[model samples]
Target: MNSVNNTDAAKPAAGLSINKRSRSWWSAPLREVLDLAFPPRCLLCEVIDYSSNSHSGSYCSECAEQLCPLPINRCLCCGAEIGLYSMSENGCTHCRHRNLRFESVTCLGMYEGPIRKAILAAKWSFSAVPIRSLGRLLATERREELQLLKVDRVIPIPQHWRQRVFRHFNPAWIIAEEIASALQVPCDAHLLYRQRQTRAQKRVPVSQRFGNQAEAFSLQDMHVVDGERILLVDDVLTTGATCSEATKLLRQNGARECHVAVLGRVLDSSA
Candidate 1:
């Protein structure tokens, strides 16, 4: 009994020693200063600052609740929200019209409201701080879907080299990294590559977006993707042109299966 008490007493000191030894040489002081200088704030609702409070990430509890996660009742192939008019097996008519290479797509949330503002704020406005919050929200929201897939690898939708250089950061990569961390999967940014830049899809006609993207991306290394079950990730899905082209490339390179996961999906007008 005395020996057990002594051992228990020593354990806390040992733990404290380990913690002291583990202090990061680079981040400890820097993070301390950062916290002191700029206290963390919620990206949405700006009401409850996160500096003093502890919630998972940037969004306040209110905004977090407001976020509408992608509904489970969606078209299996295209990830479109299914309505009363939709079919059960094949999903909506739009997916039927276009043959896609990936097995299916899972989106995290709706593109409107807070989710949209958060994505645009970080993606276009170049607010790096908000990325962590956005990523956390995405990871938390899609926990169930990610668990179901048991994804082997998380692949960020590749960006053309020039575009990556111009932007200085890739939005898709950030989101993919968060999801990968949450799911304990390998995040393979190099598995796929955008070999060349197509003209901007946003400025082009809908027909041209498909044509242009079909020629945009290519596989970087066949070995990385070949025979692997991949979860391709992107910030948003609009016409599905980009993901479709990427999926086609992965299939051609010998990937066993490709599944897409995005932060949001543009609602199909036809649906």
Candidate 2:
């Protein structure tokens, strides 16, 4: 009986030995706690954990260095990649032909490579942290541009109540809220509402997306936005249709001016 008791006592030490040999036992929980407490590394580089409550992952400094931020010389209207320009230039070719409702659209990066992947993953996967990180990045990178616009409010392109019921979250709301907090501007999410459920814009052709969202939005409380320089926000901008439609609604409701901000901007060949 005494021998048996001693043998049982030895088992715990053996288990501890095994745990020490593997190293994973310690790292798994340590990683979890660290991830929870610290900013996670970037997904692209996997070395720098950005804890800004916006970005997460393991990618570190090198990954940030690898990212290709949007060029400053891009056309103000279409966000198209362009060369050095004079201040007097009226508008890009696409803008000249299209007569857009929004005063301008500014984006953080081209909708390709890491920027696009991050936006897609954050949207489809319900990864709020990454979207927030992208939003903060936009705020930091475009501070000068945002200051120039003198935006008064941050209005997220709202999700319809029906879609919100299923998706459990709104990506645009996440972005807008973060930007609003960073910029010290008020976020007026309830000011705009999606009156109808339009099919997901991804499946539709670019030409048709605008019409699809033509009547998708309406002002919920015009007084909130009246006489304000509104900043409309979204995760990605493909055809400018979604933003344009939202702009028209804001204008109709008496917003002083509307400017669009996005994390990713799709490369339109036409521009």
Candidate 3:
């Protein structure tokens, strides 16, 4: 459902690129039609009135102002804060010891507040609206940071068949499509496939999270990613183990460099 090239999942609704649509002549009328049918409500606060929606298409301006952006001095590699980053002046300590595969990471914000609630809704509420709202926000806000990744293509972290079935929606894939669309880059939802199903990271210990995802992803076509600068997108990043394992294998298969873009990131301690 997440493949941008497939036209089944990645293809957004009839009205999309919500930000871009705001400028079009038909946008106002279309929005009025939707508001009448769907009755616009702020994605964050669930307010009925849309006065603040003029400032934020999906959320109220108050919640929008409260969105916590990632600090400026994050670890250039993992998108972690300076305190959590295992890095030094010379290089990253984790990379030196654990050998993480991705070269860098970027994200919209730390996992908290409305972002957290929206993510939970996406995962458990059986609704695509929250995902679409968050995806558009990410696309509108993070374009410059995504561009600085110097990526050749975008890929979502793959979900195992069972997980995909259980969840019914892949937020990672949805979010990746947003980033890809904004960057005008190719998005391959099937770039990586789950070789086997494993327990969700939440069910495993923090120390074992990395191992749980080890050997989990197999590239759909090795040659497609060989020597490519790939951007792996995910919903939330906590331990960084899952992305690390995927990166390691992708690079072994000849991916030149793998970077990550995530919607939300929770520190290991807090998570």
Structural similarity to truth (TM-score) of each candidate: 0.80, 0.77, 0.81
For model 3, residues 1-271, the per-residue Cα lDDT tens digits are 3335333465567767774667688878888887778776777777776575533336666665555454556777666556563454433433334556677777767677767776777666577667766776787777787788778888899888887767868888888887887787888887689999888898798888888998888987888878889998888887788898988888888889898888777876667
User: Lowest lDDT 10-mer window, candidate 2?
Assistant: 1-10
For model 2, the superposed segments whose C-alpha errors exceed 4 Å read 1-40, 48-59, 68-70, 86-89, 269-271
Clashes of each: 0, 17, 0
Error of 3 at 82 (Å): 2.6
**Cα lDDT tens digits for candidate 1, 1-271:** 0011222345664567666577667666877676668665676666646443433346667776776553657778877777756664664765676666777888765577777777778787565556655765777787887778876788888788878787857878877877877887878887678778888766777666678897677665776677878888888877788888988887787778888888777754411
**lDDT (0 to 1) per candidate:** 0.71, 0.72, 0.75
Alpha carbon lDDT of residue 231, candidate 2?
91
> Positional deviation of 248 in candidate 3, in angstroms?
1.1
Clashing pairs in 3: none
